[model samples]
Target chain A: MKMKCRQFFEEFGVTRMIAVGFFLAIAIAVPVLHLNTLTLYSQALTRMAMNGVLVLTMVPIMVCGAGMNFALPIGIICGLIGGLISMNMNLQGFTGFFASILFSLPFSLVMGYLYGLLMNRVKGSEMMIATYVGFAVISAMCIVWLFVPIDNLVLRMQMGRGLRKDVVLTDFWAGILDDLCPVTIGGLTIPLGTFLFLFLMCFLVYLYMHSKTGIMMRAAGQNPGLAAANGINVDRMRIWGITLSTVLGAIGILVYAQSYGFMQFYESPKMMSFSAVAAVLLGGASNKRASIFNVIFGVMVFQGILTLSMPVANVLLPESNISDIVRMIISNGIILYALGKGSGKK
Target chain B: MKTIKQFFSENLVVIFFALLCLGAYLIAGQAPYVVVSDLINRVMRNSILVLALIIPIMAGMGLNFGIVVGAMSAQAAIILITHWRMTGMAGIVVALLVCTVISVICGYLLGMLFNKTRGQEMITGMIAGYFGNGIYLLIFLVLFGTVIPFWDEELSIRSGIGIKDTLKMIDGMKGAMDNVWKLQLSQVLIAVFVLYTLYMAYCIVKRGRENRSAVKISVIKWLIWGAALAAVLLIPSVSAVVTRCKIPMITLFFVILVSVLCQFITSTKLGQDFRSVGMDIGIAEASGINVNRIRILATIFSTVIASWGQLAFLQNMGTFSTYTAQQNVGTFSIAALLVGGASIDKATVRQAFIGVVLFQLLFLLAPSAGTKIFNDTQVGEYFRTVISNGVIAVALVLHALNKNRKKAAQADSI
Candidate 1:
């Protein structure tokens, strides 16, 4: 009886630990909540909506068995370039949104294709190489950013420098889609427009993956050699998987930028991999599998923790990024623990 | 004539690195001589730390990304020691003890992680470092100041509950070791390097003599080298460097210990178990080896080393960019090791030294040189960062290509 009890505790201990973390967070938040419940609630919701799509992007890659998209840095850079071009072209309103998505697709596709090819060849070391390629691409893009001409006087550097790292998404399709159906209730504003678009994307992804091609992808992920033996072109499947993921990643960042209000560059997209990976991990996604549900749940819970940390601590402690620190610990700790499991069944 | 061709082909990596350096030097523009001197000195100072990355590669695990764990723990120890205001050698000694304990824990964890995922140990370890780095950030940033309530009004920000990014933790505690005997950078570099050389020489000498006494001498040489490395670490300078861009003497000792220990593992029966596990876990198990234990041990060693590396790096920088420190460290460091001519299935200590020197130099010079040549420092900086990433990409692609071809060839043979 005691042994079984010990085993049960060990099995569900992670859930308990997280529950404790939440408990502690609320304990600290009570006083702050009493003072400014209205303000805190709204802020938390805003953070969740902003970070949701980015978290969602981690799903397909995990499903395809490519592990966490540490290579997310690449997709982010592509999205940044895509967004910049759309704004610079002066495609106002819906045209700009479509244009940015259009502009980003080819780059994201090509990058993803190349990344997939490399991952296919590596067979086992995909995660690590994905990270390197991601960094390399970002680094290369940094150089390109300096040289990419910006003839738009408004878009050009203030001091005749190259494109500023943080370009305003205010112009063109800046918040066009985002503002479509924003709902303000109880002083908490929800970006219904973005949430809908994001939801639609998720639904499409879910439906598409439930088809035949997705089954092959899942198969390739589970046992590549077996899939190969069964005459499924594993490499091509991976390429397709990556292409879809990258496309989603491009959109993910766009949703993120529109909601967040600005596009920060250079190192801004650098740690996208870690964050996306972290969120998915929080949702109980592991190295080989994840779901859209995991993406949503993870982002909500993770961002909730992040949003609550600062004010709660600040009511007494004064620093705001305390939540960020906690978020970092939980995300990576989950990843580490997940990875440490001998079978890595998740 | 033969020599020239041999040099060009066989030493292509080195040749390319040298040419790149010269190109960077010309374009790097004029910095203050002192600053330039100081930077190079920093390069030399950190060389030992970088060199410590080699042995694990020799044992075929690629880059020791988890060495950051060891480095970080070492810095933590140093931080606590300095905070307590322990002076001179005593502080160094106690700090080392702390690093050792932290290293053991970190190493054991890394070793176990690597053990399970044997073939992809490098990537696994890289992630391990990133994960650990987050914990490090969380501890230093949030918990230390608020939850734990450790107080030193000087170190804490006006808004309590978080340690400042840069703490003058070692302000007066600087160069507490350098006062023992004045040592120049040349002497320090040369002395540390000679130990590596002597060990190599002893290896060669053992091969030549083939006598039992000669083998004994090799062991003695290792003992002597250990002593020498410790001496180099402890030599007192007139003024100690607190955030001075000098060599991290303490970090070097930790790396050396880890590397030697790794080398020892490879040379012993236990090492054989590790190698067998790497080659074929099933076969190793069948041969009565504890495969799981070996894998676990490998992971632990890697983790401890990583922590040590991180600790050293943090102390030297003396600041924390909580968000991104550990994110790409594994990739960059691994890229550097590869760029230095280390390969996946094969790597060596020499490769580690060469990689660190070349990679760091390129990293240093790229921004300056790229800017001067391209007339934009951002371009240079970006290019450098990208290239480090690119080199790894290229190396990995090459590895994949080679591995596939080799498999194809084997298939054909079969």
Candidate 2:
């Protein structure tokens, strides 16, 4: 029994245990301290559904031996472009959201192809290069956002030619998923539509991972040399993984924007990758390995702490804005811990 | 002919930067005097911070993105010094002292962490920097006035719980070193004489014949460099810019001192250990060198020097946004280094200096040039960021390509 306990702690990192404990503490304290635990739970569940696909994007790239897709913003940017254009064409309701997804598909495929080519060239230093590539692309897009000539009154800035920093979608696609069959019990609301969509994605990803192409991807990731010797064409496998990840990333942002009720431009998508990367990591994923279970588990724990910490800290600390600080600490701290764990052995 | 081709290939990035700067200069059409003065001031302001990246690169820890943590240490010190109402040079000294202690501890912890994450040191350091920034923000925004009990009315917000978002350095530490003994040619000559006397005194203490030759060679090199610098200063156009800019003699001297020290350290036993580990860790370990310890030392040295560099930078600027000033330190520094044509696996003091001058020159001119061409100065700002970050990405890609080619060649050889 003692040995089993030790093994449990070893296999599930102490940090993950601490994170679980922290989540449980918040869960218990919310009720014991008479805070509105139901609202917090509802908020966390909504966030988990919203952020699920973004976290899921990391697995395909990781499986193919590409590091975390720090350039996730590129795909996010493609989605933003698609969503904005769809709105500009005056599409509304579910058709508008579907059109946006349709529009983003080509851009996502093209961007993913180029990004995959770039990643292939810089094999050993993919993560580092990906980071700067993300920064470069984001900043370059800032110039585009200003000059791209989108003339929609709702989309453009109030007093300038450039696009507005944020465009509200309340009349269009906002809560398209959330409002569909939302099961409300007293003060708590469950967005069944969003949860179902997220699970569908999770199920599809699981199916793909067990498929022949998926096995080839995993084999290529695990041992590229051996895979190559067995005529696997590792580069093609990795590129496919990247392309799929990018496609999902594009879809992820569309889902996020609908539920978020706004399409944010310029620097909004800049730090989106970090939060997703941290979530997947907190779920027990590493630089070279991850899974769907890790994705779901990580997003819930991460978003739960983010939702609960504000109320909990308000009751405890009261004066300062401790929630934002706690959010920053948790996200950045988890990433640092994840990066450090795979060190020294390689 | 092949040598010429090799030279062109090696310096291709430098040529591109030179041509780009020339184009921007022609487009902006700024007066020579204005451009030169701006360049002089910018170089003096940014050189030390860029120099802070040298040691870690020498030790092969990639770009040292955690230098932002070092900048944060300096900011923490500056905040406290302001709280205590210390003014002038004394304030600067206290801040420097405090920063040194804080940065050494932070650097050691960061170094140990970096040691574990060896091959991916760049990204690891970048993440660690964000993590440190979180803690730094918490301390300043949440704990400083509430838990730590700083009582400066001016530095705190109205709520008395957090430091003000921005603080002015004019009342205390601004240009503290720059204003010290603000020099002329007479001071320069006197400093040169004093340095010569010190060198002579050191020579006498070096009683060994072998030591004498090395000392003599170094002194000769130093004299030649001194002559070249003096000649440059005497140029009429350069002198006009220098005089107009009021370039701080002390700051220039500090830059020179760091350059010399960095060069000297690389010739020492510890430096040898760093180089060996940097080249190949397995071989270094087989040779009985403590690779991890040397890497840590390199990180500590870089972080400490970066803290001092940040102090110099903030003091010169006379004001800073407490939260944002340190955030861009690593990004800007790494971008500048790459712009100078340094690669991920190699860097030098010369590259650091050259990169700073070229990068700052482009930064100084691009906005005006953009306004001239595109009728929008914001384009220039965005362009500079894209160019700098794009340069880093290109350099990384090239390095990766080189590695792949080398591996392929090795396989072919086998």
Best by TM-score: 2
B103-173 in candidate 1: lDDT tens per residue? 78877777767666666666666666666766877777667866787767666666665556665546534
- Runs in model 1 deviating more than 4 A are A1-32, A225-231, A341-346, B1-10, B29-40, B145-149, B169-172, B177-276, B295-332, B404-414
TM-score of each: 0.83, 0.92
Interface RMSD of 2: 1.5
Model 2 CA deviation exceeding 4 Å by range: B1-6, B183-242
lDDT of 2 by residue, B1-414 (tens): 999999889988777898999999999999887897678667877877888888888888888998998999999999888878788878878998999999999999999999878788899889888889889889988887778887677888777778888988646478887777565543565467677768765775775365767767766776786776677578887666545554578778877887787778889998888888888889999999988889889999889988988988888888999988988888888888888888888888888888998999999999999999888878899898899778887887888899888988999999
Cα error, residue A319 of model 2, in Å, equals 4.1
- Classified by CAPRI criteria, candidate 1 counts as acceptable
The lDDT for every candidate, in the order shown, is 0.68, 0.85
Best by lDDT: 2
Score residue B398 of candidate 1 by CA lDDT. Answer: 75
